[model samples]
Target chain A: MTNSQNNSSVVDPRGPKPRKIMSRRNIILYGTLLVVAIYYLIPLYVMIVTSLKGMPEIRLGNIFSPPVEVTFEPWIKAWAQACTGLNCDGLSRGFWNSVKITIPSVFVSIAIASINGYALANWRFKGANLFFTILIFGAFIPYQIMIYPLVILLRDLGIYTKLPGLILIHSIFGMPILTLLFRNYFTTIPEELFKAARVDGAKFWGIYFRVMMPMSLPIFVVAIIMQVTGIWNDFLFGVIYTKPDTYPMTVQLNNIVNSVQGVKEYNVNMAATLLTGLVPLTVYFVSGKLFVKGITAGAVKG
Target chain B: MNSIEINNLSLNFGDVKVLKDLNLSVNKGEFLVLLGASGCGKSTLLNCIAGLLEINDGQIYINNQNVTWFEPSERGIGMVFQSYALYPQMSVKGNLSFSLKNAKLSKDEIEKRVKHASEILQIESLLDRKPAALSGGQRQRVAIGRALVRDVEVFLFDEPLSNLDAKLRTELRVEIKRLHQKLDNTMIYVTHDQIEAMTLADRIAIMRDGLIQQLDTPKIIYSNPVNKYVAGFIGSPGMNFLKGKILQDGKPIFKLEGGWCESPDLSNYKFQETIKVEKEVWLGIRPESVVVGGEAENMPVNFNLEIEVFEPMGADTLVWSQIGGQEFRFMVDVNTSINVGGTLTVGFDPAHASIFDLESEERL
Candidate 1:
């Protein structure tokens, strides 16, 4: 066909193809993404370098350079015996305590959130929508705000300064966000699914446990990561709600870095902070890949 | 294993009554299709029968028990969803075995059932892959396999083919038909596609405005729609309508006031319901029944009109024209020598035409 007859009026050779134009946008996006990437990396780099350096190098120098004298002493001190108050117990004590609080808390919170999310999205009972709106609003409220009443409530219930109390507090505090995340995720699931599940003779709990929970592994991993990180790095709740014995990694990190002294042990502080962030960070890195794939694959087009 | 009877089922989401006193029944082992446009409550009705939706006032009987409040599992039904909602974390074998696992069946029995279902759907190799690893058609097969493992008395399909590509849709449609035959259980399917309804349904229930307008065999629904809505919904290109005056006599005759076609002979049709109301009456004629024929004396009522557009669809061609400003369509053989802006004589066979009351739009 002739060029004129080719309908150039309807088609421009250089104009974007809906599919092909992504790479151009990706270059611009990735450039900006790189800058943001560096912004996060700088502080992490400072912490790492300071954690490895000797006392003299840590005191006198740029936070970016390699440590003048790298030593494993801070790592050991931070693990076994690091002083928060009178006792010089390092992050290791709180590290175990954090694990104890996080595992059960994340599992309970994520499980409740998934159930709440599915029920709210699929079943419409009396006052169900109002409950959801209230729950979402509750989740958005700054978690620290609840500490005052929660401390008194837990104290009166005679469970304050206990590990179970800390776990309970973590579950209640993390529930709103977990619930919101899960509900938003589940709302995107096709209604045909719930219908089909029921047809398979799945009851409400049956559908939730057998169908929704199984279908939602990626989101569950994400929820676990979020709750673990939030509770693991938690300072205010761990310090106030739990006893010294039940204090999480964040409290120990706080004592290691924030001890009342003129020149703090920057190396130990960095090492302790790194120690505190490991579990949540590890949780994130491990499941982050499948979390993304799960969200897109099982959740979206399905 | 058992028949389903839905009686006066009415459901409302807030003030909008979605299924307004809807009624339909599926005989034992019959593939009943609830066909309607979206929002016409076909899926809603199917959900109600599946015990997924609670009807405000109705009785759903499965094998003679009033199961209005029965739980879905207790009601013994299997439903295939349009989305093929498979559990992501589970292997295909795990997904197929899930319900059986819930039923506390022995592990060996569950394995045996899963193996049987996978072999039937020809998805045996995909047993180890998760739902995320499968394509759309494969996921759908797995979804069907999940339902098959349930081994329930009733099977419900809520637009299961809507998500598939056209070619895959045709392939899966045949697969589903074969499954239905092999399983021989009561299947209640809901779809908006008339072709799907025409091909798969043992009986088609045409729905409109939250009511079952007509529930009959596909042949009866195509040839004898209860009203204009049923007539309009069940055919591709749909039945054409024209305002015509009814001719007086026992044998019903209608004159096309501004139509190119004159009055046709309806000598065979005896208007069963005697009604003198004929002003502005609607005439429903299927495109297949109306055709391009020869001269006037050879045909009783005929139209000689300009062909505005022609669409050749391989097997047959659709010729569109306007008579008295009302658009009309007629089917012609694909090999027919016809061109745009050309005038052709089209004939209407009164034997196949239907008359509708204008105000009510119900077939008389």
Candidate 2:
């Protein structure tokens, strides 16, 4: 080729042209994302708006509109005065019951499951795989099918309709999945670290507490979020295992929203629904970053 | 007295044997390296000594006490891993002191050990920094520091320098050698890198297929490998092997397979056993042992070969050539001018060469 022609044909390396804001790819991608976001946000918006409105405003029945006059009376009533079953003391008692159930259940299940995971991941005594297989199999079993058996079991143990009974039930049901999560997460940590711990004169419990536990903050955050949300939002186990006196907030919420004794106060129902969800929501917000990291770390390996 | 002894150690993973009938003994204050290719069970042997792996059949002794059934911690050993294996969440100080605290040492003792270890490792300034914040070399130094604080009589290193870059690996290899000298403790280091084994080891156990092919000082292993496998595994450019047969008249003479050149005189060669008759053998000549140009004139066995390629490796140039249609290599000065397709005279004394029997592949 001629020198001038060769030089002219050689194009300088340049980046792709920037696409316009309204390109088809951008439109489709952001459109689907916006629709999905709005789909979830609309219900949350309606609940928030409905909870802020007074009874007369809620009666006007424009659910999407902002309240003409904001009132927190429904919230106060949901917390104190509103009746749940025979008690007119509102969800305060049930909230405390949930606190009692959730805190211990989360801690106990995590403590046991984390140790189970560490053993399964690092130390392979005989039958460890069999034990892990059974634990994982437990995770896949339908919770509904076990309710009757669990009720009988708890009743025989003389903890039926008690806070401790519900706590025990939550702890047991939370074990299999939490253990699986912890096992997968612990497996992602380099095996050499475990070996090094063993060589450094750290025995089983020492290694677990000092090495594995310290390095596993993200996974622990993940477990806490899972157990807190699962135990707090549970309606079936709480209702089945506890009586009205010790009913968790979720069960009490069902009583308030589904009661047939009086006028259905929409604002009070929304306020109580929001209050019931507040604990888990706060947990997710607080540990959202680590939640994503822990999930990806566990999923990518083991 | 021996610091660590392993007897009849055999470990199996189901049907696959990872280590088979392995026996090793390390002298007190000696630095022994287990050198091998990957999957050769070098690291597995180190783990067995550390009590990290339970042997299927064997006994391990540390400082004259049988520790076969002891817990890893109870075995009184410290280990560094290839991945450095530092506690990512803890500061360098915490990493050093965690096990000391776990052992229930007094706070003053723990602090004293940590300070001593960090100072010796030249990581005193990094004491408060977490592993994630440190560089690779710094992190590895901290890992070594962790082992140092244990004050164990035996230290196990499972390829601790394998993860570092080439420059860092050389730097850390020297540091490890220096550390061994300063601490005067028995160390068992496992690595696939031959150079590290050669430089850092007082003696190297060259392993293959879960068995140690040779165990001797680095100089002895280099100059007089017990078998062909070790002779081939130890050197960087690798020793050149010529397929030949040894015929005995009055003295042994190695006949080239293709009769490409005159048979090399082997009268001066040392034999492990007396040669009975004509036998198939491999004549191994290390690249550095093969003198080229004018120096080839005085050698016991000398020949001219056509050079096919040359590689300049900065310090020395490796010249690739052929002998009896087999590939052969020799090292020459980097400044030596070389051209492919040119004839070059190369020679090696059989005394410096290793001859292995063709059937058993054992050194003669």
Best by TM-score: 2
Q: Score chain B of each candidate by TM-score.
A: 0.95, 0.98
lDDT of 1: 0.82
Interface RMSD of each: 2.0, 1.1
Q: What is the TM-score of each candidate against the true structure?
A: 0.85, 0.93
Worst 10-residue stretch by lDDT in candidate 2 chain A? Answer: A10-19
Name the lDDT value of residue B197 in candidate 2.
Answer: 90
What is the per-residue lDDT of model 2 for residues B253-362, given as tens digits with 9 covering 90 to 100?
88889877678888988887888677899999999888888999888878888889999999899999888788999999887778989888888898889999898999
Cα deviation at A229, candidate 2, in Å, is 1.2
Candidate 2 ranges with C-alpha deviation above 4 Å: A1-24, B248-251, B276-278
Tens digits of per-residue lDDT for model 1, B139-183? 999998998888888888889999999999999999899989998
TM-score of 2: 0.93
Clashing pairs in 2: none
